[model samples]
Target: MVTIKDIAREADVSPSTVSRVLSNKKDFFNPATAAKVRKIAKKLGYRKNTLAANLVKKKNNIIVVVISSVETNFSDQIIKGIQSEAQGIGYDIMYMYTHTTNEEEHKHILETLISRQISGILFVSVILEKENITLLDAAKIPYIFVSIKPDNEHMVIGSDDQEIGYLATKYLINLGHKIIGLAGVDAYPYAGFSRIKGYQRALDEFGIEANEKYIFYGDYSYNSGSQAIKYYHENFSSLTGIVAASDSCATGILNYAYDHKIKIPEEYSIITIDGTNLCNITRPRLTSVTQNFRKMGSLGVRKLIKLMEGKVNTKNKSIFVPVKIDVRSSTARLTR
Candidate 1:
């Protein structure tokens, strides 16, 4: 609660003198005077405000982490990793979240972190608007974006979702399910496009005709998954296997199938894109692609810290985390 004014008033010195002493500005203060000032400051429990100190020293050692939605398991793991690594390094973290429709998130983020004390920013699967991204580039603050798609012009850390799509489709194909359905978004922020591309590439390699009707585009939510399934059941009678872009989507398919009296593998099989515990707890465990959430989180934090410290150059800034497909009960050997 003590301000610099209070520290100066108690120390019986001018505010500028106190500033010079605390900042160790040897050009202005003698060793004896600096020592006395330090002694008095310690006695009064006086601490420098990070923002104030950073203005003079030009470094603050604080990081900001922003997520689009913590509503899902994936975002939570990123936060956990960031928080853990940040705590270890003694850096303060300012966390923020944005809504799906909040167009003003950029202004708020800028206002919150533009100070000298804010050394770096980490965006966990959150997209910045065009104007705001331009602002971020101009600000000279070190940053790392996660789960969020890169404009390919900024520093972004995320998984190779295209590979995930490829793996999921290839897995289904290997199991003799040539009629595998693809489900994911078709929008910006890259996950949708990259994942879908992976799926298409896999099918192309196998020389299978990709039925465009079997590919359902959704908003990457549970409800969308359900809707996709309902559409497929009504329209695509030949579909025997499905690959949902996310575990949430996969769960939706599983629930729909369960209530509709469809036998798993006996009738159809399903796979999802994430390896959360939700897979195991389902009526039949879901075979899913694991994106290593904890690693993603930790990597985001570590990258932000390094950029904050100016330890790395940002000329080429792309970090790709790998993915793994966990075989489980939901995806069984497709039966004719």
Candidate 2:
């Protein structure tokens, strides 16, 4: 292996000088000496051992990003944000996937990260249970959450889910639909619960009774949407509007409606959250609440960096990005 000693000898400099140059210790050497050392190191094909080097420095530039095994369009956009921000600050990302909500996989991944002494971790839509959090705390590995936040106040960032829910539900109400139903997925507690509350709040604002019978919960799979719609049809046939938890779920309902020959808009109006590309491609096209997931990811990395750097706020801090509704063909005025 090409070593610093070889470069030092070839460049007619001491090993210490070569070391300083290779490590980019700016104050340790003159410009000419640094330039000479770099030139000779290149010529001699000397490769610095990153692992050994980091061992001495007690630091690494790698950050681990934990994501769920079931990938979503929102997940992809958040990843792009993370990549852009991490690269901007001289850090690299290593993706780790959790096969399910099982905490064992999470524990194993956390242990691996701790063993490797990775610089930091960015959790994308995965919430760490108390045990895992305790482990991370003991290991002193700073992490930031994106797309989801735990009960504790910590460095986390996400979109304003309640606002999206309110806006969509209110839109339906404005179109003269009173018997509106909510089609929600059971996944993502932070997003799902907040949105449900928002839906309730909008109903309360308009002096409408909050009925549990009108709420349908799904597993976030495509089948969940169709099944929820079927349940709604059988029980609450008077349902005139729906605020779906996700675009994928909305698409499922749209497909079911087409298959069952249920006329949209004339009979029912629908809006979904997470305005991914799937919204535009559906037959009638879906109106959706758009959250800037890319920004959420970028902000999460920045927050983790701040924590890693020992920047402290008086209390734990979280940033919430704003959301907007994208009007589309799937919704219309109540014809009845």
Candidate 3:
């Protein structure tokens, strides 16, 4: 709780001089004096009252990040990106998680954020409802959606999910596998549905008739992957390849296959989305279409900062980061 007054007294200087030196107002003091004040402040364990300073400035240099409850494998990487960018620009980040899609809860979160006078918001895989949008609009709070694309027009930053699907499916197709199954893809209007469409597009382009039975719709969870394998085993035995919705889902499939004595890459070639570290740790390893999640996070913060600074451009409303495929042992050419 040592204050500027304590440091000033120790340095034998006025409080205002200490304040300017500590705040980096260099025009008022020389480097030597500034260094002396800083040294003394460090010695005395002095801490600045950021809350009081922000109150006087009428703005908080804090950004709130809202994350969905269904945390993905790459979420930590995204947060790392956000933290690196925000820290470089002297802004602090606060995190809040939304465990449910309840509108009342969303409203409460929004109200709490507004009350804190946060500079902006970054949403990670959380879709905003109409009421939540209205509240943000009325409050004039800038927000950028990350990892999930909302239905309406807004600031969004994520990988091209459709391209990811297309790339994954096409990779399997190029390996001479026409019978490919899709696992753990949801029908929700997000990455899952878009990826499904991409899967269909690749199938149509390659003249492979897509069988509805090959599609297993489920959330991108490990359990979903296991259930998908069970469903495919029962209904689509002729499938030679499978595209999973996530790395975790792919791992689940691998585990299930091991338990059921299904040979990987020989009996079933699997390609998963989200090229996270989990892909590398699996037994056979997973080949995956990798999304630039870290780039998405850092770019989202940059875009939100632009919006908060009133530099909004009508043309740059959405940003789609690129996706790439990582070759691994889980996938091989159709050699049956």
Candidate 4:
């Protein structure tokens, strides 16, 4: 281990002088002495320990944003938000990726954050269950939740899921499709439930019965969407429309219909959420509910910074961004 004593001996200075110079104590050394100390420290390969410095300061300018999964398009946007805010505020960022495998990793991540003295943490769209919350509480660091959520606990900001669901379904309902379906998967986190509720809200508004069979749940993957379509085809006899919670899932639906010889809109219509550029590249440009993730992510960072600075309050201090549906080739009036 390289010690201050070694560097001081090499520099021909007292350990106290070395410490004062390395800590950048302004008045402790004259310019000539400071210059000699700097040269000696450099020659000795001495580097200031950021962790030790942060410990003495009792807080860190470093903020770590941890996400459970990084595969989603929207999660990327949340990251963009964090990076933007950190850059603007001049805070260092340590990005942590924790794949959803176990409860222990979440605990480990939290403990590691405290051990390193991370000032704040931003959780983007991945729910931290009770055990994980207990871990965070033990860490005692301020945290802000972004995108994915469970009812009121930490500071959260994301697009309004209820309105998003209502809008997509309402769009289909307005297009005169009577047999609209809400596509979901239990493993997809909160998107499934929220989108289904949105679909139900639209159905209730139209005085239609909330058919349980029309609600299909599968994994929220493109392949899952393909499987979901097959399930719907076999079960829902007269399904004319489907609203997928994810654009990736919707892309799956598009491929399934094309491959299985089912007509889209002429036979069925589908809409998805999170209008990433990928939607435009698909065979039939997908109609989707668009939320600007870059903006969302940037705003999350701003909010987190405010919270860290005591400029923002936690209770009743959430930001709900609006969402818009992008109409494209995949959706059409229920023909045939």
Which candidate should be chosen as best, given TM-score against the real structure? 3
Per-residue lDDT for 1-336 in model 1, tens only?
A: 766677778777788988888876777867876777788788888877876656767666677777776234567677787777777687788787775335597677676577544777887777676777677778877777787555777766778878888999999999988888886554554777788788889999999887788789876677777887888888878888888877777778878888998777666778888787778888788888887887888888877777766787655677788888888887777667
- Against the hidden reference, what TM-scores do the models get? 0.81, 0.86, 0.90, 0.84
| lDDT against the true structure, each candidate | 0.77, 0.82, 0.87, 0.78
TM-score, predicted candidate 1 vs. hidden true structure: 0.81
Q: Pull out the clashing pairs in model 2.
A: none
Question: Number of clashes in every candidate structure?
Answer: 1, 0, 0, 5
Q: What local lDDT does model 2 show for residue 289? A: 85
Encode model 3's per-residue lDDT on 19-101: one tens digit a residue. Answer: 99988886898888999999999999888899999999988999999987773576877998898788778788899988435
lDDT of 2 by residue, 228-249 (tens): 7888888887789988888778
Sum up the clashes in candidate 3. 0
- Candidate 4 displacement at residue 283 in angstroms: 1.3
Which residue pairs does candidate 3 place in steric collision?
none
Better of 1 and 3 by lDDT: 3
Q: Model 4: clashing residue pairs?
A: 81-297, 81-298, 125-148, 185-218, 265-268
lDDT minimum window of 10 residues, candidate 4: 184-193
lDDT of 2 at 240: 93
What is candidate 4's lDDT per residue for 20-44, written digit by digit as tens? 9887898877888888888877887
